[model samples]
Target: MDPWVSLDPPMPAGARARAGEPGGARELVTGALADGTKRGDVGGHLELAAALGAVVPRPASGSTATLWESLATLGAHDLQLARAVEPHLDALAILDEAGVAVAAGPGATWGVFAAEGPGVRLVARPDGERWLLEGTKPWCSLASHLSHALVTAWVDDRTRGLFALDLRDPAVRTGEHAERWVPRGLPDVVSTPIEVEGAAVTPVGAPGWYLERDGFAWGGIGVAAVWYGGAVGLARRLAQPVGRELDQVAHLHLGAVDQHLTASRAVLAEAAAVVDSGGVTGSAAAALATRVRSVVVASAEGVLAACEHALGPGPQVGDASYAAALADLRLYLRQHHAERDLAALGRQAEHEGPWWTTRSAT
Candidate 1:
């Protein structure tokens, strides 16, 4: 079987053309995988991200589909690589949305450390003309490897603001809680807490602007695209020939996988179109993102179950790539706050009322 052949859906015509170009995203990832690059190799993954950064378009560009396609292609190749690259792309997008010029030197990778935790709070205080972040920020993934990060810190008792920090700042320290990240999937992509004292930061957008912007919704959906791609990667493994006659049960499972992936692809494409058209804004963009993410989550979970039931323990135990892919996807899907997100979507729908009404023909 061809390495690229699988249950994966077709990319848009333009996306396919860009991906097929020599030294494009597809060629870069395929070459890296062929060279036996490990998923946990953060340095190698960061380098790949820097190279792809020059090629992949930012989200909501006229071709949002191409941006998502690039993300999906990365996820399908290696979830850990996707994990490393996603935030870098997201940081760039956030900066763009905030009207901040990305003036970093070449090969400068970034991460967005916005997740807040109890007992440790990062706060930004005015220091003359500059802002200084002082406190601990949890879930700073690849902080040590990255050159800069767009971090969220408390600006006051009731507000949080986005700030950009240079990780190389002498006041910044990482690996505070590294040992706590021992999960089997994407184990190498450690999200440890970081401590900062008097680390100078540049304010990105106004306080509360990060979460309020439409791009936040678009970024969430972009992540779901990556999840969808990881599922596609797993589904492709199910179609791999095992040098033996496949049974009916296996074929049935493959069909089910196709069903889920097809639905997921449709939703992602629709979401991309909605984003590009600017039809959804403010609360509506968040609602659309919630809906798209919920659907993709279900589809990815279904694909995982189907693959496990169909392939049995043989591949899980014998195939290293299959095992790693399954593990990485499992852990990555946890980012979707499952029931909490569904409940939020439910609230949004309830407030909107009758969201499924058909339009009248003129």
Candidate 2:
């Protein structure tokens, strides 16, 4: 089978071999989880993190480019599972930036609970030698098995702090409303509201450091990589000769999807190179992330539409893997926030001037 062209540099040998397998998408995730028993975390599966070079620092074995490629590979496999795993790796990126040490061993997985939306209010109070978290945290992913979590909570009316909490503690309660996660799209990911009362925590960084850091926007772009991967997954099916007998209209749709995916990959690759070079910082980081995310999101939306129009509903209903990939990508892409985020970008662009005027020779 011919692989879809998404990244600039071709997929690595190991990743390529895995992507080429029969039922490879499901198999990799299952194998990753199974490998967890070797270390100590019987139910944990973080092999994807290590594979994506997310567990190790860029200077060590991973780079921004490698991380994005690995995320795209994972997205090609199973996106609901990919969605489940992305937060953990994103948490690692945050912790690394904050000088927080997290072991990438089997059972020592981490999660991020910084979704500071309404309905949950987690407060960190100073306790003797440590800190305790009080209140509920909404949208806590992998709350059941995560050994630790990088949580964001309101420190004051105007300040927020990031804390590292040990979920192994008895005071923390997860799955408070597991029933509410009824979306079939990412059902198994299990992102439910959590209740933490007097749960001890370690301060990760100074107040406001978490959001102010460059990694925050970098992480957003990292998520865009995953979204691109999902788009690739959808496009791969269209690339095949098996879909709908391959007509001229289908060929046109495939060409559009291929162009969209290629453009997205190139944009992401450039963004990664810029971040790795430390070119993204302060307001510049936000601008770059917004720009890359917008392009990738648009590309994904276009690919998804072209795929559906070309392939029809037969594949969606008959092919389990294809169906799941479509559903997962659709739901995961919602992270883009559509016009809201675009509007925010527009507001920023109004102050920053046009892209062509600011272009510099790299």
Instruction: Residues 160-195, candidate 2: write the lDDT tens digits.
Output: 899988887799988677777777566567787788
Q: State the local distance difference test value for candidate 1.
A: 0.84
Highest-scoring model, lDDT:
1
lDDT of 1 by residue, 1-362 (tens): 22332223566765542234322645665566677667678998998778777776677876677777777877887889888989988898899889997567899999999999879899999999989999999988888789999999999998999999999889999877787788989988888899998998899999999999999999999899889889988988888746555589989999999899898888888887778898889999998999999999999999999999998889889989899999999999999999999999999887673365765453
Clashing pairs in 1: none
Model 2 pairs whose backbones collide:
none
In terms of TM-score, the best-performing candidate is 1
- Model 2 TM-score on a 0 to 1 scale: 0.85
CA RMSD, predictions in order: 3.5, 5.8
TM-score of each: 0.91, 0.85
